[model samples]
Target: MDSALDYKMVFDALVVPAAVLTPDFVIVAVNEAFLAVMGRTRADVLGHLAFTAFPDNPHAPNDPAAHGMQVLRASLQRVVATGERNALPLQRYDVETPGRPGVFKERYWSAVDTPVLGPDGEVKLIIHTVEEVTDFLHQLRRYGEREVDDTRTALEAVTTNVYARAHELHDLNERLKRTAGQQRQTMAALKEAIERQRRFVFDASHDLRNPITGLLTELEVALSEPSTDTHEILSKLLRDAERLNEIVADLLELARMDTATPGDAAELIDLGRFVVEELERRPLTAAVHTRTDPQVMVRASRIRLARLLGNLVANAERHTTTTIEIIVTTDPPDAVLEVIDDGPGIALADREKIFERLRRLDDARRKDPGGSGLGLPIAREIARVYGGHLYAADHPTGARFVLRLPLAT
Candidate 1:
């Protein structure tokens, strides 16, 4: 048999507010946690009927059916009768203050009661554990009330302010007219921005898809036929990969320029020498001709100028079979560079629209599957950044792409 002192020590060691009760709901033992929570000494509750010691508050409303004592009694009885644990949701329970006896303090608690069975499988005792939730419940109620009060105050202020202005009809009409005008302007600008973003996404996806598709297809075929001449197959795959890399790089450059303002440092570059040098860098099967003014010089970003010139020249070379002609001339405040090719010239209706992102001719697509359709658009964007312009015109036999930039002061 366990000693009474040992049982008391075990009960006092429990951390949760727990008590052991007999089958008739008399308190047998209470832990230190229960003593602290209930604000009572062991002598006050020991061997006392549970409901008798902490009965429903005498000052509480006379509604026995809704009382805390009734609810607690029902839960404890259910646990003992069914031989199963029972849990009670948070409920109000007033406890007598320790020092000021007979004064009950308001509290809320969440409780659970479990049956302890003996050797004969009968309930020997009931273990009841409780956790206090009074402070938390009160804080939550206060917070909700504060929010409602704030909302009501704001609504009242708005109502009063609006009613006070009801007499100023003419002034209100004028202000509303101005506000409507401003809204129209804002909507127009927003619409334009949205359209630009839409086009950018569509063209970027379309331009990037081709090379990526080719790269995947090539890799798949190469992997499937291991016994074939892998060296040749790898060379083709390498070219496709390089093409994808170039398209990605161009797309990134376009994205950066879209957010960039255009004040890069400008330098005076000799137009004739610049044209000749740039042409020499290209690997071309078509013959090249140059007609340049010796004194032509432009003040611009050399990198942008180079990219614009390279794109125009490359477009002419790739799209046409005729000899390429490079021309540089001065027009007082501006310098001009022209790249002419004996390819089919752009249609009159499509000339302006061709500068749009992803605008490509059917023949061009057939001739160059690797083209990202970004070259011309990017070239024109670079021209605009340098305060210049690029446009295509009808050549006698082919196409003429002209570039104009501010001349060096």
Candidate 2:
């Protein structure tokens, strides 16, 4: 099977706006619809980073988090990091005007980024697709405005006829009251949407602030010292950038988990096989061993389950240096998986606290400042979504993390 040919055929065939980007986010190919959306030719974007070609509105040049740039970057970075599809919220992304080279026009989009895994099972390309919702949103705004105008006109007519007839005026008053009630409901819904958007921005900004500030501080210090070591400065800059990337990826996953519902689609995943595959894909210093009942299976979202398992193993790797054990078994109606590490274990007091969002031990923070403090919380959320629970218990040698899920028929 020629993956390159298949990629080309699929890329050219899709009518929906789409582009193919390298793992580093360089645009290598785009379909006509995507080109139309950006108002640019292949020659202009083919070799450039996706963000470089269509930057966020210049009004926010200094504040990438204020615009949708961070959200979009986070979505693409997640696909690259975790090899999972990610959807961005409806964003007010602006694109270059057709004839105006540097000028941008306001647009709204519902965007998604999906990973294209290579034969080696690593993410090689990311397919970015977006649906332009600008016109639809404009239509909605117009409809709302028209309703307000009609309400005003009706109110004026009623006021003019207020002295004409008492019964008629009473009927008009009742109708107006009902209209007001409906408008209030609409306003409430709109307010809720605004609040959600505000919360999303606040969370993103809060998580992004630290790394960015650190990056700037490091650069400033480096610049102040004329004899500063360029190599050392670059090394610290790279680490800070990587830290920012990790935080963004975790936030994206956390957002996904927050919106995941019990009604989400499920698949029958073999516990033993899945555990082995996940372990094989990750790089760890600890020697890993597994014990499993090959027959055990669970009906759950494969991505979510993989995420849960991956987080447990990753947490173990961060804390332990010697050996890791992964065991899978079944107890009648439930399948159980446990990860045990041979390292300093968590205190009994902090076992449950570790699963809370952004909660990390002082020791763990000292060990790894780049940790987003979201992995355990996200893993537990995924477990609950699939009618399961994840917890850490005291181990004689080290920490023991366990995941339990309903067995598939």
Candidate 3:
């Protein structure tokens, strides 16, 4: 059993009201104690700007003491600027009555804001902790009015002790919660890495099995038959060997793409001109036409982008009857490129399936027996790595593969 410390559990267990905020003062999270004290739910406070969530009482906007938001903001800013803790004095911050719009209740609090510094010694987050002292203040005021000086003094002493203890407890809880959130994120990433490794192994073994078995069977046949045609046998063996090499090459390319980081060997290219030049450099198997807009420009690794385009065009050529159309244009923020072929149109259900690694439709298998199914998947991955998208969109009479890339500024 995994005995991981559940930081969320510790955070929720905190009895003192506490919340986590970004350096910009946006509420990132709030503990259960904070929710209970504020009469709020997590959904009501999380992701909201701190001041926006707990605005000053509009009914008492002109009252200097009632501007609790200003006090809190000043304290928070002090912590951020100094990278130190800022303890606020007793504050009169009123809260709107839950389920009663426009009705605010008078409240007082003793609060502290502490900065969580990053490696660069800059404030990354602030831990805000508060203890409500409204009831105690009211009682103390009553005692003073009744001339019970001794009792009022005793109550003030107790309140001081309580506030100090609450501050210590809340700071500890906040630290635990932060550590737990980071651990959870790390575990999630590790799990994803493991899953990818597992899938890669499974795919490699499954695809390699057929070619290896065929090669062994062919060798056995050549040995057993004394009069077997040497030239024909060698030719067939060479084709099988080449097919094996292609699959391995495709697999390696996919693995390389999986680990590749962006901006490696990247360059700015005019989309239309690049497409025209690439097509001219490569021999075509079908009649290819282009309607490219020279104004469309993008930043990408030239080699990877060329491979992506080649994969799309090659896929189209394999299934095309006679013609292939390539279109490059701009759609505001994106540079759009479409490779359309006058072939059997892909069914809606199979459109997404084609992009899956080693996934080939029945027609695709019949068209090119030597084809490695990694082409489309690699193309899509390349597009994704460069903050782009490649998908099979609906076509009137054939398959339409569209690539949308963010246009370079």
| Model 3 per-residue lDDT tens digits across residues 139-253 | 7667765887767777667655554565456456556656887999999999998987787678768778777787888889999996999888888888889889988988888
Angstrom error of the Cα, residue 90, model 2: value is: 61
lDDT for each candidate structure: 0.79, 0.80, 0.86
Q: What is the lDDT of candidate 1?
A: 0.79
Model 3 global lDDT (CA atoms, 0 to 1): 0.86
The clash tally of candidate 2 reads 0
Which of the predicted structures, 1 or 3, would earn the higher TM-score when compared with the native? 3
User: Per-residue alpha-carbon lDDT of model 1 for 265-360, expressed as tens digits?
Assistant: 778899899888877887776788999999787777777777888888778888678688889998878899889988877888877877877778
> Candidates sorted by lDDT, descending order?
3, 2, 1
Higher-ranked by TM-score: 1 or 2: 1
Residues 301-365 of candidate 2: C-alpha lDDT, one tens digit per residue: 88778878888988888888688999999987889999999889989899998986777899789
Model 3: clashing residue pairs? none
Model 2 lDDT-worst window of ten: 159-168
The residue ranges of model 2 lying beyond 4 angstroms of the native Cα positions read: 1-207, 221-232, 262-265
